[model samples]
Target: MVALIATAFVQTGFAQHDHATHQTQSSALLPLYYNIKDALVVGNASLAAAKAGEFVEALKNADAKIVTGANRDGLLEHSGKIAGSKDLKSQREHFAGLSTDMIALAKGSKLSTEPVYQMYCPMKKTSWLSSEKTVKNPYYGSAMLTCGKVVETIK
Candidate 1:
């Protein structure tokens, strides 16, 4: 009985530690994600692709087991699409998908240490994530940099 109690205590401690680690890893991807977004906003497909690669690596390091189901697969698939394409238009297309999945993932995981803005462009009819309250259009770049509005803020 004493041994059983000790084992339970150890398991409980491990579970708490694992939860904290999971939170840290989940939140760690935001800055990388933002970097990718910024590159896209500047109409730099090559830079965006490079950042996407880094995002994918960070996702892998975050541990797939912690993010099971569609969220994990969607992130990997979309980020891969972004990384595999060099064309600015193609990158932005894939980025649309990536942002969709990321918004859901952020909501589900409760990631982002600060509020993440879900900004939407009326012309594109698509949304992207932002660390700030202001809109910086990733789809139109400087052609229409401030074309979007904050539709939602996830904290």
Candidate 2:
């Protein structure tokens, strides 16, 4: 039975597991994530750093049981890097990595309560999440605002 269960788990791609059907606690991440993204969109380094710090704190306290293995670890790692940086450039650079992990977590854990849009910038080859479908390029802020497209919508 143990072997059978393990085999079933292997047959179903673990990272692609449908979390919308399961109960998870990582929705706690959305508000801080959106705030950090907004701060970066306006090119506010200090606010971004503060938001990132809160992001990490909320992540630590989040009931992340739905997120397993490397996904959870990568999220924490990237969030930590963002929290440690006060420079907008550095924070934005690290934010891409954090967004990557966050996207994976959102998809795999279905932790988002409302709709989340996955936006991408072909110019920078980076993607970020947004609460709305409208394009808001956090990577470049007003310098190149609306520079990206919505690639996916997580419901």
| lDDT for each residue of candidate 2 in 1-155, tens digit (9 for 90 to 100) | 99999988886865455443234447768778899899999999888888889988877766556656787688778778777878888888888998998898778766666888999999889899999888888899999999999999998
Give the least accurate 10-residue stretch of model 2, judged by summed lDDT: 16-25
Q: RMSD in angstroms, candidate 1? A: 1.6
The CA lDDT at 74 in model 1 is 84
Identify the runs in model 2 with alpha carbons over 4 angstroms from their true place: 1-24
Positional deviation of residue 88's Cα in model 2 after best superposition, in angstroms = 1.0
Give TM per candidate.
Answer: 0.91, 0.80
Assess each prediction's global lDDT (C-alpha) against the native: 0.88, 0.82
Give the per-residue lDDT of model 1 (tens digit) for 6-88. 99999999999998998888888888889989999999999999999998998888867666678878888888889988998
